[model samples]
Target: MTKDVEMAARNGSNGAVAGEAYYPPPPAQGGDVDVDDDGKQRRTGTVWTASAHIITAVIGSGVLSLAWATAQLGWVVGPVTLMLFAAITYYTSGLLADCYRTGDAHTGKRNYTYMDAVASYLSRPQVWACGVFQYVNLVGTAIGYTITASISAAAINKANCFHKNGRAADCGVYDSMYMAVFGVVQIFFSQVPNFHDLWWLSILAAVMSFTYASIAVGLSLAQTISGPTGKATLTGTEVGVDVDSAQKIWLAFQALGDIAFAYSYSMILIEIQDTVRSPPAENKTMKKATLVGVSTTTAFYMLCGCLGYAAFGNGAKGNILTGFGFYEPYWLIDFANVCIVVHLVGAYQVFCQPIFAAVEGFAAATWPNAGFITREHRVAAGKRLGFNLNLFRLTWRTAFVIVSTLLAILMPFFNDILGFLGAIGFWPLTVYFPVEMYIRQRGIPRYTTRWVALQTLSFLCFLVSLAAAVASIEGVTESLKNYVPFKTKS
Candidate 1:
């Protein structure tokens, strides 16, 4: 096992990375049928299963913001931006998948996580940078999910309130309380051992994503066909009419960040790839999965975003599902919000598992003799379902949940926070590191045609990220003028 990637502290399971002592050993396997190159349980993730995981991670929370993002970009740029991100994500993700193995594409040692991949190809400084950016983004994502799930939960109540007390009802939604509830729910799911134990949950979350996204799309299409839609133009919102030139620029840049955020999951690409079994090679399987996943997500995004802009035009709500874009068929709207909450529950774990593993793994490795870090007590719950409880994991994970929940309560500016996270994470994790690692692993010479082209692409993306980050900060600053801490309205 590589020192850079001893992501778990516990002994045994040669290929294991992330979350110590939680994995069930391979079930009495024979031959190489159920074993990996590192001689642990052969990963059972196929292209479809991998695609499901990708969809689960990519589609939640971000999809809800697409309508407003599209409105900012207008008809011409909105759809174009979506395709551009899909293309960039697919291309760079392909580059990353090839870096799964250290030396050769097939038989080289595995790099199980994103930081592991960076540590394999880059120097110590770059490795440290990757760890900071990747882990921070993962924790940020956990916060974003808590905020989104609570918004959806509150939206359900708001919808019901409006249905009962007329459309003008002041449906008071307590976001802090809902955020706390979401935190409590995450505490339980956070205990779900490791990455490999997440297939079924990811599948369920993927289904929920499709369900809510499809509902939003169908509603938007209906509104589009019903006539009397809001103002729309090829160039998007007019500078003098909808916003000042400065506001226009900021909103457009923030819209770019939103789109970038929607295509996130590149930070965890290597981790996702690690779950795939070999034979066709992890890279090959991951590439196929990325194609299927990105294409599927792109198609749905087009429907949800473009149709939404058509329906509501420049007035598109920040979150189509929970932002009151659709009110009729209150039951369906409620169901859609419910699905969003459910989908985010699974997506939350998908991102948080890496963080949990990094911390718990370090604890176990640092103090090999510490029973508190290594011990597990199997406990039975209602219906007698069995699970493990580790003292350190329980304390640390609960604290993380509580902290994220509190942050969500303090700053519930959903779109601004998502844009900020997206802008900061998009360039380095998604584009730069992958491009650099690919060049180094393939030994592409500096200033060569391939190297120059890759560098040019990265530079352009860096510019985009810089602009979006600035815009997000400005948006958050603007939001602060009327903001009251721990009080978020729907």
Candidate 2:
């Protein structure tokens, strides 16, 4: 029998491939080619490429809004909160790597769908609900990213004399236009026929991201508040040392958001490793991915967080734009804005891909004959576009851009969208994904001292996230209350 014919039979009439199925022979492996192209089967991602994905994914608009979020949590606790969260994120990612390895070894399924495994093993609707929430959270994350990118780019352009009036309202206008433009650009960049070569783009993106962040951090440290005549003076005491009790609680809760961000992407790192050609049996790829990812993310977080608190002192905000905008000579604002724009593009790619894929997946099932609306159709069109489709490949790029533009215009005013989204959406994806996966793989992850300690910490992290989500939503609502048009004054 032919290879396709055999797979079709083995896969059954419903077209569902069994989770426990093993690789058949060479011809069969080569025959079922939907997952990877010929070159893709041979291409493996490097440590640098994996690192880029992890770092970019974590450093979204949240990096920009972190200052504000931390401030809302309490200014005195801001930096401490960032550091505390960074530590949790680092450890949680490590624990996730261990869980992934254990599960893969036991299941003999190196390429397991995280949700499928979790859902099957946990056998709980809440687990599945969490997974669904994760997916939605990621979508919100993409929205947050694109909106932030628009605002950053607008701020950069205005500072560079691109905007004539330099109007505050223009920030929102420029942001919306950028959303449309970036969406178009992403369609092409994403459609690159040669993904192996695309690693170079990720490299350039990473260099831009890290280098700009480093410089921004440095400039922030060297900054001195000036008088009206522009004369510099020593001012702005160090922030976040010996914070008050309320500030301490705020910092702790903010830290939970950071942990959620890290947890959300652990499975992505594992997926990328598995996709590599001739992957390590000992799975050294997981170690490499995690080590580089955690280290890079931690360093950037520290640099941005510390310099920001130190420079602006009480005035500093959490977002990268805040760090970028607080520098002297004015021209630095343009430079910082530009860096944020470039870095945000790379970050947006990682955040948007899964949401786009999920939307495409549902579209395909719901409307099998919708032409280019399905993921399969988009892939085929992408093959034709060869990475620069302009407008043809993946039209949803335009739709996403439009949605993001509208969201950027509206939600940014809310000022706490990042924290709110991170709280409501990011928590389940990051905190619960690994724990649920581990529970599925090995019941309750053993009650050893270390495991028990981690679980307690994880549970605490969950509670913090729950509180943050609730508080942020309430805060947003309260802020909106002031803007609401009432018929009568109180």
- Tell me the tens digit of each residue's lDDT in model 2 across 153-210: 6665555543445434333233456666765666555453222444556566666677
Question: Which stretches in model 1 have alpha-carbon errors above 4 Å?
Answer: 1-35, 322-326, 380-385
C-alpha positional error of residue 200 in candidate 1 after TM-score superposition, expressed in Å: 0.8
In terms of TM-score, how similar is model 1 to the real structure? 0.93
Q: How accurate locally is residue 222 in candidate 1, as Cα lDDT from 0 to 100?
A: 84
Off by over 4 Å in 2: 1-40, 66-80, 98-107, 124-127, 161-174, 190-198, 224-264, 318-320, 323-328, 359-398, 443-451, 482-490
**Worst 10 contiguous positions by lDDT, candidate 2:** 13-22
Model 1: which residue pairs collide? none
- CA lDDT for candidate 1: 0.85
Best by TM-score: 1
Question: How many collisions per candidate?
Answer: 0, 11
User: All models: lDDT?
Assistant: 0.85, 0.51
lDDT (10s digit) by residue, model 1, range 328-404: 78899999999999999999999988787767666776775566876666676765466767788889998999998
